[model samples]
Target: RSASNERAGRRSRPAERAGRAPAPRLAAATPPPAFARLGQAAATFSAGAAPTSRATRRSAREDGRRDASTAGSPLTRTVVRVLEVVPTRLRIALAALVGLGLLLGAATVVQTVRRRRLERQRRRLIADVGVLQSALLPEIPEHIGGARVTAAYRPAEGLAAGGDFYDAFELPGGRTAVLVGDISGHGRDVVPLTALARYNLRAYLEAGLTPRATLHVAANVLAPHIGDRQVTIAAAIFDPGMGRLTYACAGHGPPLLLGTDATPVTACSSPPIGAGAPTGRRQTTIALAPGATACFHTDGLDEVPVASGRLGREGVAEELRAVGPEGDSAELLARIVRRSEHQPDDMAACIITALPGGADRWCLRLEELEVDAETLNSGWAERFLLACGVGRPHLGTALLEAREIVARDGTAVIEVRVGEALAEVRVAAPPAVMLPIERRPAGSSAAAEAG
Candidate 1:
């Protein structure tokens, strides 16, 4: 019986040892939550135990699937949000492009309009210049009384209007006065003054005023309007009935006289019309011989510098003589102009040749006036006498005849003795052209005095 009890004690000892920890509960017998928690813990432990092993890989795959589902699900939602922003950004970029295009179009249109406006203004100004230039008549009366007049008008380049003008109109006494003037300054600014000068001169000339009186009136009339600008004028009145010229100058050059010998001479001129402090004086009378020639010109001719390097009257006289007797009035003028071919100044000249009347006889005479008899040497006198067509042998005889008259009057005059009669022969200045001389009627003292 004791042996049987020992076997039983052995078996009971095994059970006691097994029941010491109360035999941990089986995963299947634990509560559902606990069992699930316990299963997750076992899987996590398996993954950690061998991270690269097949069992851990299976556990990792299961966890990865859950993670993928949780994280990848938001990718679609993020893509949708990005797509929503694309349209707004594109709209902004397209709007900016449209705005830039509008600005460029506006700029182009503004430039086009401005350019067109400027072109229109330019055209208008050009038209205005044309009108102003055309207002000056191209045709000048070639014949006025016994005098033939021709003029030339050349405008300066780039100038809107010139300051030069000339007029010829009959006075109230049936005599005609010629007026030529140059107002200072240019452009349309001078147009008003030019018109005023024209009308005023016409009115004054028609009022039968002398050249000097007309100039005085004109100066006063223009003084209020002239401002700082002044005028240069050469005005004259010719009385055909009396063969006399009344003249006045306003700081202008003297007219040239063409003597019968074809030699150029100068007129004795008074002070310019507006130049003198005492208002200047006028030349009441200038005796124009029957065949004498008068030439009026602007300073442009005289002002040109010659090869000799002289200016004004000196140069002009030299040039005129250089042209020689081969050239006529027009030819000489052309030659004078050619000397200053490239000059910048404008030139104008008026030449008058007086022709004698029909059925009349005239003689041309030349005399040198000097006080000293030594100055009047025979050679010098002979040369002038020869030029005047007086015989050399008769020169002393002519001088003797002239001395007799001088002895009686304390003056000297030489009478050139020519074999031919004075009635048929004609003489002229410059020898380029000849004019007839009419005999004065008897008892016409005024006319004779004027001649």
Candidate 2:
């Protein structure tokens, strides 16, 4: 009886344990409410139910979820929820577009900044070029050595300055020398060569060398220095006492001599300076009478392109004649420059006109006189006297007289008449003071008698 009872107890215990284990398993396998609804909809679709409106479907899902919560297993209810805010392709395209826009904007900014920097550098370079040009070419004297001298220089279009240059300076014994030249090219590259040639010519002439000899010396000095560059020069020495002009040319145009007859003084012609071995340069002397004008110019004037053809030497001569002999040197040259139609090269010219009357008739009108004596030393009076071919002694005497007159008369309009043998400084207005000036001949140191 005891053994049978123990067996019954054991069997009952095993059955109870099996029942408890199933209860725990069912609880763990139960699905959530949302996933339970999803399973019901999937099962309904599989059963071939007709599709319904979104609102009807949503209401049906809610009602089904209530039933499923009570009936479905826990494991069948739980699921992951995924929401797509933007389409994958759309998002990728938008990102790419935004990145491309940023890249282009950066590139544009860099390009604009680079352009502005280049512009600034270009302007600074142009300014520097202007300064250098001014230094290389200074204003020349209007009158020198008993001649009315005037010059006109025109650089090539679109250039600040060019290689064409001219200079006129006084020599010993009442003589004047003029130089006109053109280097190979225009602008700053040729400035050094221009300066060297101009100054060397002046120095050689000042040393009492003849025109031909001066040119030879200049060629010798410049040939080795100028590299692959050519130069054309026309040099003239005028002696007012003798009324003679001695000129030499090196691959340059002939000087135009205008008087009763228009003639071109084409005496000497040699290879251009620095071209090759120096040729024996020869000079020609021509009588330069009063009321006559001599025009020296570079090839720019003759090489101007016209409708017919280039304005040759004959055309240049004709233009000069049309300017008329009575015109002032300054006015004449200005008119010629204006008439040029197509000037492709740098133009430089010098016009020398002998005064019709003697030096005595040369009049310099001073509107006002300064109080300082030093002003008398370098004023219109002195410049006019020097232009009138006054020697150093005569110039000193003239300045002394001018100083005395200015001291006596405070501020007055004075007329200075520089004659060959005398200089008269007289006040034109009230408080008049007349200072007579007597000048001795050249090479004589006779004290000037002043009254």
Candidate 3:
């Protein structure tokens, strides 16, 4: 009975406790402002998380409450309480708007920077084009190789420079050489080739190479870089005293021979360089009379469009004929270039005209020197020719035949040919010194004397 009475007493005490409100819970007693602060913090966290649904917001709310409790500072608690006074839904909306604004602003900044960079790059490219143009065009001289010279340079449309280039300089032995060349393709790629070809040709010519020999050396040197690129080159060396022009061609356009009679004749050249090695190739020798003019130009002349597509060599020749001889060479070149309407391709031409003064008639002084046969075969010959701007062809051939002639005989006669005059070279030689050269021109003769 006592145990039953104790159980009833326990039940009755719990019922009494439930009947009275458990004095308000501590969380419920928390001020509204404090609740608002916690709500705002929860929204901030939730905005960052972007969970699947509003239900997940509870996780953020719990995290916020823990952070507030752990803070332990009275000032932080007061501030948090103030923030909590804001409505939870409104707090969440504000945080989302702030986050979106920050993201949009960041994207705009990145895009603006990219645009500015691109504009800078564009400016740099334009400046680079100007620099390239200046370097490609060089100044030319009015006189070359004891002759008056005239030239025309036509730049391609929309380009500051074209692929065509020409040079004329006097070589040793009173020989003068002229070279005209065109590099394939256009733009900066051609610029380097122009420089290479121009300098190489000049060096070879000045090195004493025959026109044909010069072409050979230059073509071989440029072969590695040519790849698919081909070069059209025409070179000529004038020996006014000999009244001959030694010329070679590597697929370049033909030159026009402007005679004193005002008659225009066509001078042909060989195949273009870089096609292959030329072993048995022979140079063309034409009689260049006093008061005669020769013109060399790029194919851009015939490249202009006609109804039959691009005009061929025949068409270009015809055009020059039609322009007539009375016109100045410079004026004629300008007319053709203008006629071409400034072709899309490069156009350049060089003119070398022999003034009325013919050799001795020109009253030029001459000097003669007698040297030994061994000197002709020795390195001295090469050095001498190089100084006079002559002898490259002789040097290359001399090396090959030097030993053969040395075995044939121990002594032979050597001669020096100067200004159309040949002088038998008297050499003091060891008995049996062999001389390789046999044929020599006895004296100067006007092969084709045109009245």
Candidate 4:
């Protein structure tokens, strides 16, 4: 009975060792209850939180699969694997950088659209103002009365229009009236005042009033309408029949008289028109010789910039002298404007030159001649051409051209001038006429004949 009891105890001991080994295997196979709850909470937090990027969600799913596969492994091993896979700080920094880039791209697109819209509106405004300026200031005629008239105008650089104006027109009894003026301020606002002063002064002069009286009347008429603006004007009446020029100044620069022993007509001036009642203005009369030039200009001519300072009145005079006595008025003004270093204001200039011979001498006596006579009598025309120093061949050509013109046009005035180097012929039909004339230089004619 003792031997049988010993065998039973040994069998029980082996069974106990086997059960202990299986117990450890069971524990490794399944996670603890606390670890399972922690894993479930982590899944809930991932699902309930704000939506993450596709890459982040994919990585989270992969981490979950790996943790499930390693469930039979140690808990410390699972924790170390999660820490290696997740990089919260680096991912947050990358996301912030991407968001900033998107914000900047949207801002650039908005700014570009706004800038283009503003540019289009500004260009359209400039075009409209240019058209208005042209209508306000018309072109001056080439001839007024018996004198040759020429003018040039240049607005300030980068401006469409400015406050300088000039006008000339024929008056009664073969007299010419002229005006050159400057308004106080620039741009579109001053244009109306400029028109008012110019047209009103013209009306007064055409009424046969003297220059001083004309200025006085113009000031009174414009005073009420000019508002706070002022106008500087130089007005003149030239009578070729009387060989005289009468002028008045109203706070304006003096008109320059060239090609004679004459001085600037700048005395007896008053304040600019529209500044107070017109008073104490006087007209100065000067003898204008044949071939003399009368030049009138706005302040822009003298206000040009130079190395020393403003070109000034003396600089303008020097430029005029450099143009020489023979330079045409239009050409001279062009040269002066081209030489200016900077143009800060509007420039306007006009010139009237008395013909070398009297107005009648330049016109053929066509009114007294018989146009329909059988032979077209040219004896008188020949004598007039000879008096003008025309040679025999040029004289014959002038007579034949004149006779042909009269026969075709009924009545025509012909102008003939003979010089050492050139001969010119001008034919016109009249009331007010600008003749197209041709000049033949002696050298060129001789060369043609030889060829």
Tens-place lDDT per residue, model 2, 98-214, is 999999999999999999998898777766765575466556676678677777676555444567888888777767789898888876679988899889888777776766667
Residue-by-residue lDDT tens digits, candidate 1, 235-351: 777665666555667667656665433331122223333453322233334545455555666666665555755356766666556643333345545666667634444455555
Top-lDDT candidate index: 4
Please identify model 2 stretches exceeding 4 Å from their true place.
Answer: 1-131, 159-161, 260-268, 325-342, 357-451
Assess each prediction's global lDDT (C-alpha) against the native: 0.56, 0.67, 0.62, 0.68
Top TM-score prediction, candidate number: 4
Among residues 3 or more apart in sequence or in different chains, the pairs in candidate 2 whose N, CA or C atoms overlap within 3 Å are: 29-74, 29-75, 30-73, 30-74, 30-75, 31-73, 31-74, 31-75, 31-77, 360-419
Error of 4 at 426 (Å): 44
By summed lDDT, which 10 consecutive residues of candidate 1 come out lowest?
A: 423-432
Stretch of 10 with least lDDT, candidate 2:
361-370
Candidate 4, lDDT over the whole model: 0.68
lDDT of 4 by residue, 235-344 (tens): 88877886767677777776676766644323223678877644324345566666777788898888887777888777777777776545655676677667777788
RMSD of 3: 18.8
Q: lDDT for model 2, on a 0 to 1 scale?
A: 0.67
* Decreasing lDDT order of the candidates: 4, 2, 3, 1
Q: Give TM-scores for every candidate, taking all chains together and pairing residue i with residue i.
A: 0.46, 0.52, 0.48, 0.54
Better of 3 and 4 by TM-score: 4
- Rank candidates by TM-score, best first: 4, 2, 3, 1
Alpha carbon deviation, residue 229, candidate 3 (Å): 0.8
